[model samples]
Target: MLLIRNLIYWLLVAIVTPLFFLGLFIGAPLPRRTRHVIGESWARLLTWLLWHVVGLRYRVIGAENIVKEPAIICAKHQSGWETLALQEIFPSQVFVAKKELLWIPFFGWGLALTNPITINRSDRANANRLMLEQGTNRKQHGFWISVFPEGTRTRPGVAGKYKLGAARMAKQLDMPLVPVAHNAGEFWPRNAFLKHPGEITLVIGPAIYPRDDVGPEAMTRQAEAWIEARQREIGGVGPFAHPDERKARTA
Candidate 1:
């Protein structure tokens, strides 16, 4: 049954993608509301196809937190499932994804219509610059931007240190920050297409926006501190930094 579902999932991905792109381009000359409806309609279509065709059930939380205000979302990176799942969380979200994703067969090209912030991961310097510039642009456009701070996934029990990309973007833009942690990797291991059934709980914390008197460094430290503490309180597993160090982080 799982194999059959996977087959249908792949087929749906292949079939609906071109129709999505066609709707995007041909529907562009329509009103802004119409275009937004088209884009959202495509999101819903893909979600429906994936759910009915694939046995994978998707669940999202904290939708109420950022529904009104745009933010920089810092989430734990696990399987590519998070990427697709994020669409269901906020169909209006503009992601900071790897530049290579744009080269992917169908979905990548389809994503280009949404103005996602794609970074060149091969070059650290270039990627950071793009992150900062694009972060501000998307924030100004009233769209939430999600960044997987790990840059890549880790095994279930081996999650690594949190990267500073999402924090840097939040601080630079002086926007509200939201941290979401999930245990998706235990079910969807990296580089493996087989997905096991499990509860992928996405926890969204309070939004953190910098104070007028505080600098980016200070604000980032605070954001990190808050999340690290919450993770431990919730009995988070994997590699975690010292709570004190996170709170006192200046660099």
Candidate 2:
């Protein structure tokens, strides 16, 4: 049954959706918003398909606090699920990710159309410079840019260090920093082929603004601490809790 669901979903998704996008790109008079709407629907449809295929479901909390702002999203990157899910929920999203992801087959081409803020992961100084550049550009373009401050996906119950990139962008752009947290790893963890049946909660807190007196270090710490607390409230240990894992029981 699961295999059947996966097959049908991917057959339509992998073949039909891109073909539709291609058709629209060629001669169709579809507006950019229309294309984005179709992409959003596709994300939700696939998410539902995958859930039913594996009998997995999830919930979100405090999503109301997220406003449509020209701001930076300091998200906790745990598993790749929330990235697509967030963009689906908010179609005007401008994702600032490592430029390496541009190599993905279908997705790479799609993002180029919207012109996302891609950064070179190879050069540290260069990447930071590029981050600020793209952040400012996305702001001017009126796209809400999301930055995963953790830099990389966290192991279940293990939070990675918060980088200064997100804060720097917020300061440079003078935009509020919206903090997003999700307990996705318990269900769709990093490098796991078999997705498990569980509830994944995406809890988005309100935007955190930089104080007139504080520096980047202060902004990073506050955003990191808030998300970490939210993660703990959802039943797992805080991101800092590497406190001796008991073999990580797959949820």
Model 2: lDDT equals 0.71
Q: Candidate 1, residue 35: CA error in Å? A: 5.5
Candidate 2: misplaced stretches above 4 Å? 1-12, 20-35, 236-251
TM-score of each: 0.75, 0.81
Best prediction by TM-score? 2
lDDT for position 51 in model 2: 72
The list of candidate 1 runs beyond 4 A from truth reads 27-40, 58-64, 122-129, 212-251
Residues 1-251, candidate 1: write the lDDT tens digits. 76777767767767776787788778666654455556666667755655666545555556666546777887777676666666667636777878888898756766666767898868987887887888777777677888776677755434466677777777678767787766566456678655554345566767777566866566556655665554443323212333433344433
Whole-model Cα lDDT per candidate?
0.65, 0.71
Residue 91, model 2, lDDT = 34
Cα shift from native, residue 214, model 2 (Å): 1.5
